[model samples]
Target: MMTRAFRTAAVVGAGTIGLSWTALFAAHGLTVRVSDPRPDLDEAVTEALTRYAPHLAARGLDVTGLADRVRIAADVTEAVRDADVVQENGPERAEFKRELFATLTREAPAHALLLSSSSAIPSTAFTAQLPDEAAARVLIGHPFNPPHLLPLVEVVPGARTGEDAVRAAVDFYTSLDRTPVVERVEIPGFVGNRLQNALSREAVSLVQQGVVTPEDLDRIVTDSLGLRWATVGPFLGAHLGGGPGGYRHLVEHIGASMQSLTDGPAPDADAQERLIGAVEKAYGSAPYAELSETRDRRQLAVLDALSETTGTTTPKEEN
Candidate 1:
């Protein structure tokens, strides 16, 4: 399925998230150039790729071949010189992103898809000032951490983003086996992060009020909502709840609850600290490793089952 490589792509920043993006793109048979000014960028990128090799294999990728296609660049200009796409994961600071995007826009191909992996920054804020207003080529391409495992990639267009650029970015990501969700408008935190922070804020409030321990609250999510969320999004889950018709009935009854819960105040500092302490006490020094391992394994099993059920066909060749 589209065995021809993606020609070339670049990953800027080469930090954990940037390296992870490089690994995923390389694993999908793209020739990747990674750039970061950090002194130890090479070592960090290599380490990330090494760790990701087997994970890609588990997801039906050919890691050994993919490794041969990657190149490390010493600077920004070299990285995007011939890149068809650039996934930038620079620091979250607005000025840094603005400067970085401006610089890359100068070197990147006129139509190159410039995607930011920033979790919080709206693409328009950073892209608005580029010469040629090539910021139109820039959009948010937020991938979940260790993107190789997660199929979801949010594609958010900035106010000035060209419609054609957005479409091409979606097509490119889809060709790499990612599920691309097009965000028609830019918003802070996008969708996933916003939902996560909302739940986390409430968890903090509960612990501050002594209504529940951190461990108990974590259990509720891990044991319930998390399971449902694994296969489908909340809206899809609600659509299914409507049974025979899908969404039509559910929206009529429960849409108001969703609206009502939208603007609740976030936790105060005292509540945040108490909850943070509860989490530290509950999980101690080592947190998320065991739980992550468990979740990854379970997710793999689920993928395996779904593959068998659907007849694990190779991706169809994209035109």
Candidate 2:
């Protein structure tokens, strides 16, 4: 059984992320109040729940009339009045977020968690207009494309964000069966999007340069790097690649060669210099043999799951 740290949730905005969040919240047994200025907010919510209901059921959540748990608030103020957490999925414009948060901080209960679905905008940027007290409770809760399926939720806090609020955010997401990775620093695009942007840049370059067609490029990544990354992260993957010697050996032998492989005219010297240190700082303490075994186990588990999905039956055709 899972513990629900929160009961009432106010989803501000009813767009893609907002709609998915609404469904996920309700599926997790949280009373959801959704606020959006859209005239078709009800239809949107219905369609989203209808689409996500099956997926939620596969994940062991009850989908029978799950829409009954949701309420469409007249406005943000009414929506957040009794909310235990307020998730803002308003426009990405910084000014819009700045203004939206002003109202959220004022209208939502003092104890209510304030989260934003901003992909690139940092919490500090929008929360700047807020006073210290309100800003302390505000943070970024950025999710991957579809919140209902993906488990990751980047919990990014501003300079003034309180430790309690950060901890609460993690607990809140965990309660919803979401994986909340609390970022140690606040940066635009946070970590996920930054890594995505970096990979995308090269991907576009490769396609444009006629190195590989888009279709084949995607197949290559999805079959190779994507599959590998699904188990251990890039950092851990590199650490494991070193076999018995670990990351230090990989750096000593092929670090320069790997850096040369990038398309950059000049590699970021500072990052290049810090590469070994940072990688070591994160993974050096782990016992090499045990870590390798763990990576292998994770890799096999992912492969086993893939075989079930891809071998016995073909994957669902993407629309």
Best by lDDT: 2
Local distance difference test, per candidate? Answer: 0.79, 0.90
Model 1, total clashes: 0
lDDT (10s digit) by residue, model 2, range 217-266: 99999878987888789888898788667777887798788878866665
Q: Which ten residues in a row have the lowest lDDT in candidate 1?
A: 279-288
lDDT of 1 at 53: 91
Q: How well does candidate 2 match the true structure in TM-score terms?
A: 0.89
TM-scores, all candidates, are: 0.76, 0.89
Deviation of model 1 at 171, angstroms: 0.9
Report the CA-based lDDT of candidate 1 relative to the real structure: 0.79
lDDT score, residue 2, model 1?
31
Where does candidate 1 stray beyond 4 Å? 1-5, 242-319
